[model samples]
Every structure is written in C-alpha cells, then in structure tokens.
Target: MHSEEDAASACAHATALIAAGRLAEAREVAETALETDGPEPTLLLVVARAHMAEDEDDHDDDAERVFRRALDLFPDHVDLLAGYAELCLRSDALDRPGRHARGPVLLERLRELAPDSPQLLRATASTSVLATAVAKGPSAALVQSLDLLQALTTAASPEAAEKDARRRAALAPYDRRLAVLDATLTALARPGRAPLRLLVRRRPEYLFLAQLTVAVLLLARHVLGPFPLWVTCAVVVLLQLPLLALRLLLRGARARGGARASGASAAGPAPAEPPLPAVRPYTRRQLVLIGAGAALAFSAFVTTTVLTHLEDIAYPRYEAAAPYTFRGMTRTDTGDELDTTAASDPSGRVAAAFTYFYTGGSGDGSELAVTASTGDFHDATAAMVYESDTLLSSTPGVGSLDDSWRADAGAYGGWMQCSRYVEYITGEHKAICFWADKGSMGSVSFKASDMSHADVEGLARTTRQTVLLPASSDS
Candidate 1:
C-alpha cells in the first residue's frame, strides 16, 4: 500500500545521510521507512548501503551492528543477504573478532531463502571453512568450505537454455578469477616459491640460531626452570625460521638452475659445429626433486627444533633458592624444593624447583579437568615465570603476554593456557631451570616495552638456582 513518493523520499534521505557520513542517521531514516511502509526491499537495500558507508568511514563495528540489525528486520531479503555475506567476508579479511561469529547460521538461512545467488554460494566456498573453524574446528571448516565452493562452481555454470556467447561472457570473469588464483598457487608450488626470500638470505644463520635457541628453550622450560625470556626468545626465532627457509630454498634453486642451464647451453652444438661431447640439460623433474629435497630438509630442521622444545615448555619455578628441608609434605607459597626429609644444612647457592600438577573433578568421579593458575606466573616480583601446557595451544588466559604488560610496576603479567599442542607424548615430564635479576635497564615505562631476552634468561637461571633448587642438595 506504500506509494512511490513515500518510498523515494525515504530512500533519498537515507542515501543523503550516508553520503554525509551520518550512517547512524541514515539507518534511522531507513528504519522509519520500513516501519511506515512495511517490508520494502529497496528500503532494506538502502539500509544495507548505509551500513557499508559506515564501514567505509572506519566504523566497521557499527556497520556490522547495523547490518545484523537490518538483516533481522528483513530476514528473507536477498540483496540484504548479499550485503551481509560481503560484510562477513570483509570482517574475516580484517581479522575482526566474531565477524564470522554468526556466519554459518546466516549462510544456512541464505541457502534456504535465496539458493540461487552465486555470490552467496562463492562465499560459502571461501568463507565457510574459516567460519566453521572459528565456530568449530579446522577439519570441519575446511571440508564445508570446499563443498560449498564445489557446489558454487557447478551452480554458476552456463545453463542449457542460455545463449552460448552471453553465458560465456557472464561466466568468463568468475572463471578467470579462479584460473588466476590457481595459476598463482601453481607458480608458488613450483619448488622454491613459498615467499621465503628473507629466510634464504640468512638460511645458515637462521638454522643455527633456531637450533641453538630451541635447545636453550628446552633446557630452560624443562630442565632449568620456566623463564619468560626463554619462551619469548623461542617464539620470535621460530616465526622467523620458516620465512628464512623459504627464501634460502628459492635462492638456492635459482642459483642451481642458472648454473645448470648455462652449463648445458655452453657445451651444446655451436653455430657451425656440433659438439664432440654431448651435453645434457638437466630434466625439470630433477630440478624439482632437488628443490623439494632442500625444502624438506629445511622444514625438517625447523620442525625438529619446534617439537623438541615443546614437550617441556613450562618452567614454572622462579623464586629465590632455599635450603632443602623435608618436613612431612610441607608446601611453600613459592615453589620450594620438597626436601622435607630432615632439617638440612644451608648451602652456598639456593635450589631451584619446577613443578607441574593437574587437578580436576571430585577426587575421581567421571573425570573432568578444571585448569587453574598455580600462582607461580602471577608473582609480582621481578622474577617472571614463563609457562606452557602440553599442547602449546596459546589460549589467551587471564593475562596479557602480547608485549602489552611491560608497564605498571608492582604488577606482574599472568599466564595463558594453550590447549593446541603438537606431538604431546603423554606421561613424559619435562622442566627447565634458570633465573634473572631485574636491572634498571630492564625496567619498562610502557606496555610495549622491549626487554632483553638474553638478560631475562640469564636472570631466570640465577633465580631458579636461588629459589627452586635446594641449597643443601649438593652437600
């Protein structure tokens, strides 16, 4: 029953507000039109436009907020649906948390409402895997995304009733984009093409550093005592290794290819005379194999370094060393060595201790684990204890280790529990020992302060000896 004039006026005002960077105002106007006229697709479309405008103006949160609101208002609307899908895609690209929070459900809704929209189908193929991963697991997400993409590729094919030329033109761009993506991937897969340029230049240095650092981290996390310095150093080094390896592999392959090609051409038939010796050009297969083997070796080295350190990453003890004294299961606030056997004589150096304990479910009914912080990492002193569980999951716990806790005196950062572990050999225990002293130069003035990894590790070793180790053990 809505007239053209009413719809036009509402849409015009909405568009003008959007143009003037008044997204919130535009949304209000569009909503007013919907209230007055009842379910006008164009008005809903205008509202989505306003959301997009808001997103462009650095108000992505507001944009998504408004998009969701408008979708709620017009659930069966396709244009609005497409707008939502595009917003989800953009959100994922921007790494905005919870962008795909509602993607799978919304995608399912779209399938039921507008099953024929190619863009929706394409998004399902591309975005669903990640969406599902965020909402579920990686394996499930990947499988779903692939299925959607396959379905989309099939659905968008030329229908039998269409004119060949028109259909080809209509489908040509989509085909070309897919082809370009495949070609780019193909080029990347040709031996040494994995964006490893940085790694290539410093391959030898990186591999050596990676191996040494990994060993140091293992020693600290498992054998010495968990020191933040060791864990942080290991992470930065690990990230750089792959980049360096890719670079080295690419460079080495190029150098070998150039040498082989030059050697072959030089020894081949000259302009006037055939060569007395038959020179052979190396097969592409051989070059590929060599490049692959080199890449594999580099990968193996990095993987070995990563895995070896992971088993015992939690070096949780970091208090001044104390004398060993066992007194019938006495527990200290700071982890002290359990030498409760007798009143042991004090030694010259303090003892360091690293302990790992898991507690959950009533003594044993059905079995459930409720992980809790051991307070070792929460110590407000200068001693920082770095801890990680079996999986190396890196779950953001009750604290910030993301280089944001460098400031605020008298407050130490808390530990994060990571469930995502790799190659965990159950029942195998690991610990590291180290200590550190907070120097004036080590003090931080802000959240983004850069502390010396080496100094921290050294201090950690010292601290471990003072606190976790028993002074009388050596005696």
Candidate 2:
C-alpha cells in the first residue's frame, strides 16, 4: 500500500482470491488496501466488487458506498458507472419509491459517456420498458415510459406503483444477460492470462509431441549408441512418463484443466459457465499401472545391459575350433583373438574368433575365420570394405573390391555371399556366410587366391562343416 508496486501486487492477489471464490478473503485484502493506500481506482473497484459479491439483497448494500468512493476518484470509469447503475436499478425495483431512482439517471449519463458500455447496454434492458421483453413479468414499460426511463422518479398512484415495483424486483436479475456476457468478456483482458490459457490447453500437447519425437529419434539409433537405442528410448520415455501420463505424467504430470472456474456475478449474476473438468493427479489405479510399466521398463533396461555385458564377456565361452584343411595345403599359421573389454567398440568386437592361414604347394594362400559374438557380421564385412573405424584395424579386405558382391542365405542354410576381388595381382574370390539360430550365432569368412564364386561357396560350406560340426563329422 505504501508504493504503487505494493498496491498493484495487493490488487492482483485480491483479484485472484476473488476469482477463486474467496470473497471474504478478497474483501479483507481490498478493504485493508482501501483504508491504508488512500484511494486507488483499481483497489476501490475490488473493494466494491467484493462487497457487492457478498451482499444478498437490494437493501442498502455496502457495495454502493465503495462504488461512490471509487467514482469520486474516476467518475467516468466505465466499469464503475455501470456497476453503480446496476446496483441502483436493483435497489429501485422494490418500490423504495424515493426517487424514480438513481439507476435511470445514471443510465442516461452512461448512455452519453460510454453509450456502448457493456454495463450500460445491459442496464438499459432492465429498464421497466424492456422489463416487458422478459416473458411473464411486468406488463408495461412504466416509470413514465413516455419520457424514456428518466421519469422513473416521477410520482405515480400508490397502488399502481407498488405493483410495478414488485414486478421490477422479480424481473431485474434475468433482464440484462447480454450486458453480463459483455462485462465478463471485458474482464478477461488481463496480464498472464494468455500464458495460463496455453498451459491449461496447449502445452501438454507440445510435451507429448516432443516426447514422441525424441522416442522416434532414439529408435532410429544414429545418435548415442552406447546402449540399444530402443531400450534407451524406453528409459527416456519412462523418465518423461510422469508428465506424459496425462494422456499421453503428462502419462506424465498432465495439465488436465478440463472445466472452467467461475463465480456468480455481483451486478445481475456475473456471467458464468459450467466448469471444465479439474486437473487431477493420477489415481491409485493409474499410479499402480504406471508403476507397473516403470518396473517393466527398468527391468528391460537392466536385462539388456546384463545381456550386453554378457556378450562382451562372451569371449572365452566359445570353445576354440580346429582350423580347416584343403588338398595340397595346410593351415600353417592359425591363431585366435578374443576381446573381453566391456563397453569397448562392440562393432569391431571379436568376442571370440579363430583365423587359419593356409599355404599351398605353389605358395598360394588364403585366410579363413569363424567368429562367435553379439556383433553383426554384416557390419563387420561392410565396414571392412569401407575401412570404417567401426571395424577392427586388423580386419582383412581386398582394397576397393567391395563392388563385386552377391548374397543368398537360403532359409535352411547359411551359404552364398561371394565377392571377386584382385589381390597380389591375382583375381580371387571372398565369401562371408553368417548364421543365427536362437542362442547360437557365428559367421564364416574366407579369402583365397584364384577362388571363384563356386570356390567361395564350397569353402564357406567346408568352413561351416569344419568349425560347427562334430569333429568326427569333419571327415
């Protein structure tokens, strides 16, 4: 109250309280400000409104006194004049027959000052002239209708007057609904309302879209590749679930403001609308369901992590298989590499693999490998040709020969991915065949001099027979 800033804050708080239907509290705040802050128009209006909201009868209401005081400061204030005029009309309706009543005179004044004033326009309807416009009410536009509502204070017969006053009182409240609507509209123009409207209506949708977009991107997996992107996305979804839960916890903290809030009008029933459904927290059932989903999501993440770690550690699990043999050639140098470091580059990760270097009588040689791991053999082969860092540095490739390639893994057997490449000035063929059956997985890769597509297929089949079959069947 000491400063304009303080007064404005008080006014905002009081208005909010009023909007919340805390009229008694609103009145207390407004009244305190009026007494201490000297006379500010907005504060006066609040005080008057708070008083009008509480007063039940047309009898001498305290709202009138506050209105008069506010008007003394800003006499032409559109809201003040309209509010005061409405109160006067209601007051005069009861045959309080002292003057045609101040309502008519005030209306005539407002008619000039703010002719289209929502309050003034509304008050015009309540004139006994328009009272007949309300069905089953007063019969005629009395109060000296000839002079145009101004002669409401003119003397009339006691019997006729008493009858008309009774009619006015009954018809007053419902008569000026249009004005109430207009006044309510005018009140809606205020600060911070647009943002609240967005929060209550549009922001939730945006949050859902953002969450969906993130989920889609994560699912695509081009970014943040440490974990299975799908699982990571699930985890992210869970993180955002609380807000997203609203529908879509928005299933997150949902801004579910469904019904609109309103209080009764002071001047002829302030416009009212049925409330929107209220914003609510998740119910017990909803919470339980969310908790169940969260538990599952967390469990999946843990399970995926454990499996991935197991894969990285899968190295020493695969029994070292014997190298294959060919006519007039021997697996002269054979060795294997097993990478057991978890979270290292999984793409190039050879959990366990055996490589055979074969030497023929004419110094012709080839390399063959059988690998078992969680990493994809397809990427391994592709990355080898492209020399991408995703593959192991030692991964072998006949440089720039990736163009000649064909693949055919008929459902029953892993056979047939062959490529013809030139190496050491000799045309040769390479074959990579991969297989996955439930928990069993591995791939066969062969590279040799002068090997044709048939040779590639034959070697792939022989490699499978050499590595995957029982030792006795290798014969």
Candidate 3:
C-alpha cells in the first residue's frame, strides 16, 4: 500500500546512496522499492545503476541484465535507453566483429523519441562519430563529428551551448578529440567578415577539397619531374582565394537585400516592379557538387598514378660507390662490394647499404655503411646518434683522438665520432664515425692495428666527403 510519494522518496534515496558510493545500500533500497511498489521504470533504473556502481568484473554483465529487464517493462524510456547506450559505449562489446553494438541501437531509439532534443542529438552524434571511427577511420569520423557539433551548437539553448563550450575548452589541452572540437567551434564562432571565415565554417568540405587538390598536385609532380611541397601548397591556396571572395560577396549581398526588404515592408509596398532576368549564381549545393567532382577526379588520378608508377614508387632505385682510398689505403676490388637495398611507399623513400668495406696500409680491414631516407629524419637521427655516443663514451678503456673533433656536413647534418681502441676488451684498435645529412645517415668503422687516432679521423672525413655525400645529395 505504498503511495507514489513513498516510491519517489525510495528512488531518490537509492540514487543518493549510489552517488555517495554505497552500492550495497543503494541496491537494498532499490530492491525494497521494487518489492513494495512493483517494477517501476525509476526503481528499475536505480537498481540497474546500483549494480553498475559495483567494481566487480561481472558488474557490467549484471547491469546489462538488469537494464534489459527494465527495458522490457518500459521499452521507450529515454533515461533507460541513455543508460544502456552509455554502458554499451563504455564496454568492449562494441569492438566485437560482425555483432551490432547496443549503443547505436539504443541511441537511434532515443533519437526517434526526441529527434530535435539537444541532449539526444549530442548523444546520437557522439555515438555516430565513435561508430564511424570503428567502421571507417579517424578522418571520416572527424568530418561527421564536426558537422554534428556545428548542428548541435546551432540548435542548443544558450546555457547548454555555453556548457558544451566550457567542457571542450577544459579538455582541449589534454585530449585530441576535444582539441579538434574546440578548433571547429572556434572556427564557427569567428567574426562573419574575418578572413577565411566561410571556408573555416565549411571545414570538412574544404578539407576534402584540399586533399583532392594535393593528390592531383602530387600526380602532376610525378609526371612533370619534381615540384617543391611549399610551392604546391601555395598554388592550392591561391586557387581557393577567388571562390572564398565570391562567397563573401554573396553573403554581403544577401545581408543588404534583407535590410532593404525590412525597410520596404515597414514603409508599406507602393507598386510591383518588373522582375529582373533570372540569374542562377553559384550556390552551396553547386559548390559541394564541384568538390565531389574534384574528389572523383582525384581518385582517378591517384589510381592511374599508382598503376603507372607502381614499380618506381614501391621499389625506389638506390646507388652507392665504394671508396677508392682511405687513410693511404688504395682501392681493393677484392674487398666487400656495395650491397644496396631501396624501399618506398606513398610517404617517401629509404635506401640502405651494408657491405661497403676498405683495407688500410697494414692490411687491416674496415667497413662503411650508409642508410639514406627521404622526409624529416633530422631530430630522430640526432637523438639516436647522441644516445649511442653517450654509451660508447661511458664504456671503459675506449679512447678518442680529439673529443672536440666534430664533422661539419652542412645545415642538416648530425655527426658523432668514437674510437675503437679498447685496452681491456680486445686489443684491436678502430675508429667509428656516424654522420647524418638531412634524412641520409652513414657509419664508418675503421680497424687498423697501426692506425693513429688522427689517421682514423682523416679516413672518417674522406668517407663523408666521398662515399656518403653522393647518397645524401640524392636524398
């Protein structure tokens, strides 16, 4: 004989207990409410939440069972669907192949119940972004997420929008997801007349367009020999400037027309004037169509490029020459020949060598190897060389000719010199030099029983100037 107020009070008490971290107490209260007043949606939610609050391995399983039973009783409840969807999203069930995750299903149901609701739209959009990420990739998910956020911000109440902005701002510094969201929001909120405002607002479309343009530029470069990346980028920006200006002009015209219409309506209409000739200017739909066409063209160009240059792109050509002389040692054709390997992909090229050797005056053998790669490898090579040098310096009984002797290979070069003379570990004395220019790197190891530290240094310099320079220049 419990009243409705008693049921409400019991549900509230259970919610408070769960929030206070008293899962057992919350479960007890919810169970008591269910027994007293039958299975109500609120009581069921409380019971489900209480089970979820437990930190056991099987807590999610128990929570799912409870939620399923509650949903059976109250199928279309927003609170129940939101809770279930949230649970599914947080669980690994979504990652299972060939299985439909409950999160999307529940979110879709919630969307049906409240299509225009800000909270429902946000949840649905977020879930869609996650689902898209799993199925497609981050880029596709990013585009969808940006569109959803733009719509959500435009439709939400001021308070809700402010809260969204605050949440994004707080997470932007630490989380990439929120950082992207913050950037999109910032672009959307830009002043109407600001430079690139129109382009930024339609970022996803423009980004796609930019991608297509870059792909075409890459294809053109491949066919026309070579072009600088900065030059290509500049051309793309210049091409888009006219379109941006047109959009700005259209926006201004629309604003002015609206103002004139307001003034005319306020003053009352006099006589109808003859209509001007119909002029169909470029619309947003038209612009989108143009972008789609460009994307399709880019796809064809990329496919052609891949098919035509498959061998050259997949397996780049690598060339290296053995040093003629090193530290008064003449060329020995009997020694190790240059063993070269080259690899390439859409990113860039990498060339490696292993068996390039030299013989000193005393018949002592030495080896020189080089690895050259395209793109930014400066910092990585520097850090790796520094670490190796530190370890070599710390090794006992290892001495160097001049600790201050640094190789100058130009602006984009990193060099390290170490001695191979070990008093305690094998009496074999040698000199090791590692140098990098831009993305190209080389290592020279000199082993000669009578070779002085100065002689090794001279050999290292000669190796850099002759053997490694050619490979680095091509990089």
Candidate 4:
C-alpha cells in the first residue's frame, strides 16, 4: 500500500494543475494516480473532472454519472451534488422554457439541503433571476434579482457573527471571501462608475492598441460611410490581429523579465552570470513611425465614431417608408411605367409567401431554397427554415437565408424605421398607420394599450393573408 504522503502529493499535483487552468494536464495527472494506485473516491472525483474537461459541448452526462459514482462511494458530497446540478442547468434536458423544470426542482432541493450556505444561496438566487429574465426580458428580471440580492446581502449569519473569533482561532478562512464579494458588488452598483474605465486604466497598453485598431476600421467606414457597423467591427478585428501578436510578444518579454527577477531572488546573488546580452533599444525613426501610426489610428477612431453619432443625431432616419408610386419600368434607365403598379403603402406591408428559388442554373442543384417567404424578411424566416429542417437533416449548415437577409432586415438604419419596415413587410396588408405615440402598433383607428404574444401572432397571420401572399398570387 502506498504511504499517505504519496497519495497527498499526487492530489496536490493534480490540484495545482487544475488551479493553473491546465485542466487536460490535471486530468492526466489524476488518471495516472487512479491507474497506479487503484479505485478510490478521490480518484472517481478526478476522473469526473477529466470527463468535464473533455466535454466541450457542456453535455457532460458522463461526468454527472462519474460524480454520482463518487457520491455512492462517499455519500452527501456537496461538491459532487453542486457539479451535477450545474450540468443539469446547462443542458436543456433539465432547465427549460416551461414553468415546471428539472433545474428549478433541483435548485429547490439544493436550497433545502444547504439553506444558510452562502454559495448555495447565491447560485440559487442567481439562477432563479436568470430564468425569470429569460422568460421576461432583462429590464424586469434584472431589477427584481438585484433587489432580492441586496436584501439577502444585508442579513448577518452565524458565520458572520463569529468572524473575528473564527479568524483568531483559525476556524474559518472562507468567511473573509464574503466581505470581498460584498465590496465588489457595492462597487459594481455605484452610479456613474464605469468599470471599463478601470479596466482601461489597469491595462492601458492593451486597450489603447485594441481601440487604435478599431479606430482604423472606423476611419475606413468614414471614408466609405455606407458599410454596416458589424462589417466595420469585422474589419477592425482583422486589422487588430497584428496588434494582438505584438501584445503577446510584449507579454512574453514581461514574463521573461519576471522569471529572471524570480531566479535572481531565489539564487540570492549568484556569481554574476557572464554579463547578460545587451538588449536592443528602439531607433528614433522607428519610434517616430510608431508614434505617427498610433496618432493616426486614434484620430481615425475618434473622428469616425463622432461623425457616425452626429449623423445619427442630426438627420434621424424614419422606419416607415415614405409614400411613393411603385411602377414596373418599361424602359431600363427611364421612369417609364409598365404593367405592374406595385405600390407600397406607408406601412410598408409584406406577407410570408413560402416558395422555392433556384440558386444557379449552371451549378449542381445542391443549394436550392426549400422554404422561402416574401414578407418574412427578418431573422424569423431563417429561424423557421432551420427549425423545420433540423429534424430531417443529419448535418445542418448554411441557414435559411443568404447574406442579403441582414441588409433586407434594414442593416443601414436605426430600429425606428426598421420596426415600420417590419410592419409593412410582415403585417397582413392591413393598413398600419404610424403616429407619434410613445407605445402603439398598427392602425391609428384601433388604439393598442399593450402587446401580447398572441397579438403579434395574430398580426403575423393577418399579414400573411393581406400583404405577404395576396389572394391573387395564391389562386
């Protein structure tokens, strides 16, 4: 039988790897211990950890199974239970859209078992708030959760009461963690206090370089003002790669410097190692170029951002389409009228007309549109196609719509006009007149007090009939 020291050392090594975020290495270390020593409760725990590291999809039913096996060996294991519950929460098999879900039930069980446990309480409360938020968007759920958290934070527990005594007696080290968390929360809650500013201050070089690259993209956007912000962001990301490399190089240099310092301190005045190689300094010309590039990048970023904001503020775009006559052109270049008088109403109505479109006549008909809609222009169209087809296809790729979908969804403008465009395209050709009301949808004649999911669905159905697929086209 192995000595206690050997087992403890193995455990320590595995734990160190885990703390260093070398999870794969930790798993290997753990597995080695288990394989060499034999089956044990701690070995099972380590094996479960290895499974967790391997499971990228977060579908760690295997890990859960291992944890359960560990629990069987050593019952009432809090860590194992916690891990299992977390797994359940991540997988949609447990916590779902419905009111009664496995996640909620599991959480309730956890609460019963560890009511006063601060960690358990925090996790339960946070998850509860998250679920509520998912069901009802952020504004409503965030406020409720914040209130609950604040109230709970104020209460003194048995642990808190004996903090000083516990600290002196060395009975509790983890209690101090609560104080740190509390302070962090307090700082986070402070008004007009931007944490991002603090982040920039701490890592000014990284932020500066990143933002400078972003600015260069914005300058490009300013030069070619029609490009979408998302596209600009993509460009910025691509441009920033070189800077990211530079940052990594600099970080490596710092790490080497730190290592050198640590070695010097540890050795305690080692015979001066043959005078260290002289470090190269930046040339004046190189420094000037770097400074100029930085200045230009920053200037571009500031100018582009300011201009974009200014443009948005000054010449505010409207959602609803302006009243215009739509005539099929008889002549290509001129406004000569043809047979079709396809005029769009001020509402800009459309309908969901399911049809298929050929991609290319020359190519092998591999990519043919199965489900296409006229009015269903937004993300819903693609979502519908994917949802309908996922069951049939083994390997799903290239979602419902093309790149044009985003542009069609009004990528160029703000939400206001986009909202109207949606109404026009989606709303059943039912006359939807826009007004200056803070909250309302559709007809001015019928005043809308509030909107429900059913109301939206009803509107969708109506839009399908009236605008999207007019009876004439269907018949």
Q: Write down the lDDT of every candidate, Cα atoms only.
A: 0.41, 0.48, 0.55, 0.39
Off by over 4 Å in 2: 1-264, 267-297, 308-320, 323-328, 331-382, 385-403, 406-418, 422-455, 464-475
Per lDDT, what order, best first? 3, 2, 1, 4
lDDT of 3 by residue, 165-241 (tens): 54643532222233333434444343563434445345446656666766677677667866676787697788677
List model 4 lDDT by residue over 1-475, tens digit each. 6766666667666664443234555567777777777656665676576566544444266676776677677665555555555545555543433322455665666677776776465445435546634433333122322322332334363234234322322321112222222333333334553432233123335445556666666777667666778976786677566546434433443344323332221111122221211222334664565576678776886787798776544421113221121111111222222111213333332322122222222221111222212321232223332232332232223222211111121222211110111122323211112111111122111111243324423332332223222224333
- Model 3 steric clash total: 0
User: Where in model 3 is the C-alpha error above 4 Å?
Assistant: 1-216, 223-227, 266-297, 300-397, 404-431, 435-442, 447-458, 461-475
Runs in model 4 deviating more than 4 A are 1-9, 36-39, 50-55, 58-62, 72-75, 90-102, 111-241, 247-475
For each candidate, give its TM-score against the true structure. Answer: 0.24, 0.33, 0.33, 0.31
> What lDDT tens digits, residue by residue, belong to model 2 across residues 1-475?
3999878878887776665445676777877877788888888888777765554543236777777778888988877877777667755455555323888888888988987767777767655545524412221122112111111223253234334433442333222222222222222223433332232233334444444455444434433345555575576666465433322311111111101112223332222431212223434664555455555545555655665555444321233454546645566553324434223555554334444455553522245556544333322223233332223223355444543344443332422344444443434555455444322245565565555666665665565455543224233
**Backbone-clash count (model 4):** 12
Task: For model 1, give the 10-residue run with minimal summed lDDT.
Answer: 439-448
Error of 1 at 259 (Å): 63
